[model samples]
Target: MKILHVDTSITGPASVSRKLSAEIVEAALRRHPDAELTVRDLAAQQIDHLSSAHLAAAQGTAPENAQVREDIAAGRSALEEFLAADLIILGAPMYNFGIPSQLKAWIDRLAVPGATFRYTESGPEGLVGNKKLIIASSRGGFYGPGSPAEALDHQESYLRAIFGFFGITDVTVVRAEGVAISEQARATAIDSARGEIAAIAS
Candidate 1:
């Protein structure tokens, strides 16, 4: 199996999502001991936001500067990595009730016309449906099904929508929410998420 491990947390070792994602990756490795793993830390290697130059370059225009060329190449590389992976382990931490900008930028590279998705007569059709996606989601507050803050949850929701748009239906979420509520709450949430991971591993 080809596994793609993507980490977007800016908190380094203090990131809960990072810890869970690493554990998920380890479990996946144990399942497929010979799996090839590729790790991409978006916080460390930031992909530049899409600009007019990037759009123009995508339309067959030559890159105007070295920076544009480098950025465009990076975006292509990111898309290639996504396309090559059989399973994806994503570390996503909520920031202001949404995902990090770096992760969004990486996603933009994947949402290409006729590559990841296409417009059919019926509507939009996703091309990359063969891959499995597991999200390690960490949130500071309550945002589950019936929580008061559920409507404010754009992190996991957006991730699901985008990946679904890419035709991926085999998606799983291991979430640790309310981590900032209290020490006990944080511990309970993490312990619960670990339990879910244990099930996945088994």
Candidate 2:
């Protein structure tokens, strides 16, 4: 088995999403002791945002300068990493009711046309398959269904839509929300998320 772990939270040790995601990976590792691991700490890594030049390069419309070429290669590498992994764990925290821009940047790399998905006569079809996605979602407010802020939530919802588009429908989210509501709320949320993580079958 191969596992790809990506942590986008910039809060280091104080990040609840990272904390939960680490535990999730640990549990999975225990179940698959021989699994290979790849870690991509977005906050600590240098992943450039996709730009017009990169797109042009990808489409073969523009000559590849050194930086443009490197950017395109990095995007391909990121996608290849995802494709090579059998299981993926992502630490995603809600920022202003949405995912961090860093995570969005990484998604752009994975959403390659004719690579991750393709347009067919039946409409668009996802090309990537047979992968498991686990998202550790952290939020400062409640965004679950029926919550007042649910409509404003784009974090987990967007993720589900994107990964599902890539044919990865076996997605699970371990969420710890309302961390800023109060100390007790934060503690309770974290504890609950940990329990969920512990119960995971890897």
Candidate 3:
């Protein structure tokens, strides 16, 4: 088995999402001892945001500039990494009720039509399959199912929807929210998320 771990936190060692994501990957390794792992630190590597050149290339237009060709190649590499993984672990932090720009850039690269999805008579069909996705999400405030802030949770919701578009519905989201509220809450949330990881790993 192969696992792709993508971390998009800019908070460095202070990032709860990064810590939880690492723990999640550790758990997966415990479950599948021989799993090969590939880690992509998006904040560090900084995937390029889609430009007009990429848009044109996606539409099958020939690259007129060297820079455009470079962008297209980079996008293709990112997409290939996603497609080759057996399991994907996303370390995502909520930024203003949505995903960080780094995560969004990675998503833009992978959401290539005819590569990740297809339009079928029934509807949009996902091209990627047989893989599991685990999202380790951190947020500043509590946004559980019944909470008032639940409606503000576009981070996980959007990820689920987009991955589903690619035919990956077997997704598990482990959230550690309210970390910025207090140290006590941060500890508690991390512990709770770790317990969930343990259960999943077993």
Candidate 4:
């Protein structure tokens, strides 16, 4: 299997999301011992945000300036990676109740017209499907289904919507929330998330 591992946590080794994401990948590796793994650390290799220059280059409307060429090439590479992966493991830590801008930039690149999705008589249809998404999410506060802060949660919700738009229905989220609440809470959350990962079908 081709497993694409994407890490977006900027906190390095100290990041809880990074730890959990690594564990999740390890669990998957145990199942497919020889799976081909590709790693993209967005925090380390920062992807340029989508811009007008990028659009102009993509549409071939104007001359390809060096920056525009670079952005367009990167966008194509990101899309290629997304399309080739049979399984995606993403490190999605909540930043101010939403996803980090860097991660959002990557997602923007993936949403290419007539590539990942297309408009048809049946409405917007996804061209990409039959892929599995596993997200390791870390949140400072509790924002699960009936939690007090649920309304403020946008990170996971947005991810679900985006992947679902691409016709990816098999998504598993191993979330470690309330990490900043207390030492006990942090331990419990991490442990619980690890247990869930262990229970995942490989």
- Runs in model 3 with CA error above 4 Å? 61-65
Each candidate's root-mean-square deviation in Å? Answer: 0.7, 1.4, 1.4, 1.2
lDDT tens per residue, model 2, 15-126: 9999999999999999999999999998887578977787677777864478777767777888999999999999999998899989999999998888899988898898
lDDT of 1 by residue, 1-202 (tens): 8999999999999899999999999999999999999999999999999999998998899987999899899999999999999999999999998999999999999999988999999999999999999999999998988999999999999999999999999999999999998999989989999999999999
Model 3 lDDT tens row, 107-179: 9888878889999899889999788999999999988799998999899999999999899989999999899
Candidate 2: which stretches are off by over 4 Å?
A: 61-64
Per-prediction TM-score, please?
0.98, 0.95, 0.95, 0.96
Clashes of 1: 0
lDDT scores for all predictions? 0.96, 0.90, 0.91, 0.90
Candidate that beats the other on TM-score, 2 or 3, i.e. the better one: 2
Residue 10's lDDT in candidate 2: 86
Structure candidate 2, residue pairs in collision: none
Model 4 is weakest, by summed lDDT over 10 consecutive residues, at 55-64
Of the two candidates 1 and 2, the one with more favorable lDDT, higher being better, is: 1
Reference-based lDDT, residue 201, model 2? 61
What is the per-residue lDDT of model 4 for residues 1-202, given as tens digits with 9 covering 90 to 100?
A: 9999999999999788999989989988999999999999999887899777776666767645786677677778988999999999999999999999899999999998787888899798887889999999999999999998899989999999999898888999999999999999999999999999989953
Which is superior by lDDT, 3 or 4?
3
